[model samples]
Target: MKKNIPIFRTGDTIEVQVWVSEGSKRRIQLFEGIVISKRNRNFNFSFCVRKISNGDAIERVFHINSYNIGNVVIKKRGDVRKSKLYYLRNRIGKSAKIKELLTKK
Candidate 1:
């Protein structure tokens, strides 16, 4: 049996380094974005990340325990409503942004 570890949550901005394989080449790709939602728990866990690219909003879902994921670095925290930020899709520009929370280290 595999033991699950709690590592991330919604509203956290994280930089994820993922390993990608293309034929005989392997490389690490970096993705930085805010976690908008988390679903299930333990081995079935998954989360969605939202980022703006080329003046367009982009969202991606990643598994918690996938081999492609190399590391996750939390960059900032956000104040939000509900567990999922699906409403953000309808928002644009400044209205779509999440408020940053200052944390005491």
Candidate 2:
């Protein structure tokens, strides 16, 4: 059975909880970042997330249908014009921030 993953798009700020295993022990790891890109290939669909930690940029690509993914929580919607936010890589500090898209809920 496929896990219920929320519908998300590039530029959205999201937190992904992943199941990590170390030998006989297992734990949930939280990865919070901005979605930079998405690849739609039917069952091979995947997405890339980027985040800054300790002054270094870290990016992780996760398969949407992977069982290791515990949950995906959308924090904020970004008002970006591009489908792939690759340009954000060159930015630093405040310049790298994406505008939040307001929605009537």
Candidate 3:
């Protein structure tokens, strides 16, 4: 993982800014979603984010040390017991939601 990236875990809602380049144009694209899983392997550390868009579920995997990742902002901390929230894939609406964890400070 990179030094600038903050500590995050599965079930957390996070917004990631990714740099997109199209020919001579370049822009930052935001992908906001819940982290379903994470893989830690030294330099190959990565996490998967899942979101619902246009009634379709979309999942994206991002490498922590990738240069294309501009930034990651944790929107909400989830109170989940499991490390991998793969069960959320089959859920919808309220069923797919995760409970928020209250933090002091």
Candidate 4:
């Protein structure tokens, strides 16, 4: 992982800015979602993000140390009881919501 990226837990919401290349042009694209899980590898680290778009659930995996990733911003920390939120895949509507964790500044 790159330096100074905030330590995020499984249930936290994050926005990742990624670089996209089209022809000879490059632009930054944002991917915001709730973290589903984090994976540790010998030399690679990755995380899974889930979001609901147009009433459809979408999940994407991102490599933490990739050059394509420009920034990772934390939006919210959830008060969750599970280490892995795979159960959230089956939830819909109000049941899919995660309670936000209160923090002291």
The order of the candidates by TM-score, greatest first, is 3, 2, 4, 1
Quote the RMSD, in angstroms, for model 4. Answer: 1.4
Pairs that clash in candidate 1: none
Residue lDDT tens for model 2, 1-105: 355788888999999999999999999999999999999987668999999999999999999778898889999999899999999999999999999999998
Runs in model 2 lying further than 4 Å from the true structure: 1-3
Arranged by lDDT with the best first, the candidates are: 3, 2, 4, 1
lDDT of 3 by residue, 1-105 (tens): 467787899989999999999999989999999999999997678999999999999999999889899999999999999999999999999999999999999
After superposition on all CA atoms, what RMSD does each candidate show versus the true structure?
2.4, 1.2, 1.2, 1.4
* Clashes by residue pair, model 4: none
Q: lDDT of all predictions, in order shown?
A: 0.82, 0.92, 0.94, 0.91
lDDT of 4 by residue, 1-105 (tens): 488678888999999999999999999999899998988786578999999999999999999889999999999999998878999999999999999999999
Residue 105 in candidate 1 has what lDDT? 83
lDDT of 1 by residue, 8-101 (tens): 6788888988899999999999999889899977556889999988988778898867878887788878877679888888888888788887
Q: TM-score for all predictions? A: 0.85, 0.94, 0.94, 0.91
- Record all residue pairs in model 3 with backbone atoms less than 3 Å apart, i.e. clashing: none
